[model samples]
Target: MPSHERFRTRREKMLGQLRELFLAEGFASFSIGDLAERFRCSRSTLYAVAPSKEQIVVATVRSYFKTGAERIEARVAASADPAQQLAIYLESVASELQPASATFFADLADFGPANEVYQENTQYAARRVQDLVTQGVKVGVLRPVHASFVGAAVAEVMGSIQRGAIQEATGLDSAQAYRHLADLVMTSLADPKKPAHERRAT
Candidate 1:
């Protein structure tokens, strides 16, 4: 590859490694020197990724969420059923977030730039849930409930989860909380008059 291509490839690799490190141990405690040592690279090399520790954390967090959203969408796209789509979306989100340690979330909340990325992702998730709910109702798989209302409620719960309130209140981690939310949404949308198999489809 050309020199620029080589640099890009190495940078991408470094970002992926940094993302995993942050997810497992959080970023707030790691300085640029620490990260450089961890990666066996010079400070200048790390600086190529970002100018400072905070910027690096922000970039890695953003990259992690971006990759997660793409994966979740791909999983949801594989299922044709509207109800299954909703389930897959939420479950996929949980699965994607399962590797993140509590420390990582705490650090994310403490960092303004990183927290902004997280907040934006949460907002997008709320909108996606609303769209899925609307689709389910249109196809008669779900009851004719108000999609926007359901979306808003899910958004509130999601915000609470992101802020550590859900963990404090229920002793459930973010991933487990999402799974429960998926179950709750599916159960509430199931039509009682339908046959068991049909209901199960939802």
Candidate 2:
């Protein structure tokens, strides 16, 4: 393999371990020294992938969300049924975020750069969601409401959920909150002509 590809492969391997650690223990507690000791790698090896601890955190979070968006979009495009696509896309989002802990998100909110990465992803997500809703409306699977309004509202709620507001309002954790949100949105947006059983199953 080429040197760059080899390096990227190594970095992705290391990032998998780091992402698990961050999700389980939170990002605020670990330092480069701690990471090196925990992962059984030298400081130079860690530095080769991420020059600093904050950069590592940002990169890990970005990777997690980026891959999640890709999977959700692919699922959305997999079917011709608009109702099914909506269900799959939203439910996929909940599944993707189910592993994150409160502490992991709290740290992201406090870290400006990492938080910006999140914001950018959320903006992209909003656009994707809007497009899906528009398609649904065009096909008559969803009600004719303003697509921008629905998309923006859902994205705002998701942002609040990430910031731990959902946990504060309800005793549910982030993952549970996402599941509930997906259910609620799907129920409201699902085509009335579709059988209830089908919508629920989707």
Worst 10 contiguous positions by lDDT, candidate 1: 193-202
- lDDT tens string, model 2, 58-126? 889888888788888787788887767877877887787778777887888899988898888777776
Tens-digit per-residue lDDT, 1-202, candidate 1 = 8999998888888899998999999998888888888989998888778888888888899999999999999988888988888988988989999999999999988999999999999999999999999999999888899999999999999999999999999999999999999889888987677775765433
lDDT of each: 0.90, 0.82
Error of 1 at 80 (Å): 1.2
- For all candidates, the clash counts are 0, 0
Query: Residue 177 CA error for candidate 1 (Å)?
Result: 0.6
Off by over 4 Å in 2: none
Instruction: Provide the lDDT at 81 for model 2.
Output: 77
Query: Over the full model, what C-alpha lDDT does candidate 1 score relative to the true structure?
Result: 0.90
> Global lDDT for candidate 2?
0.82
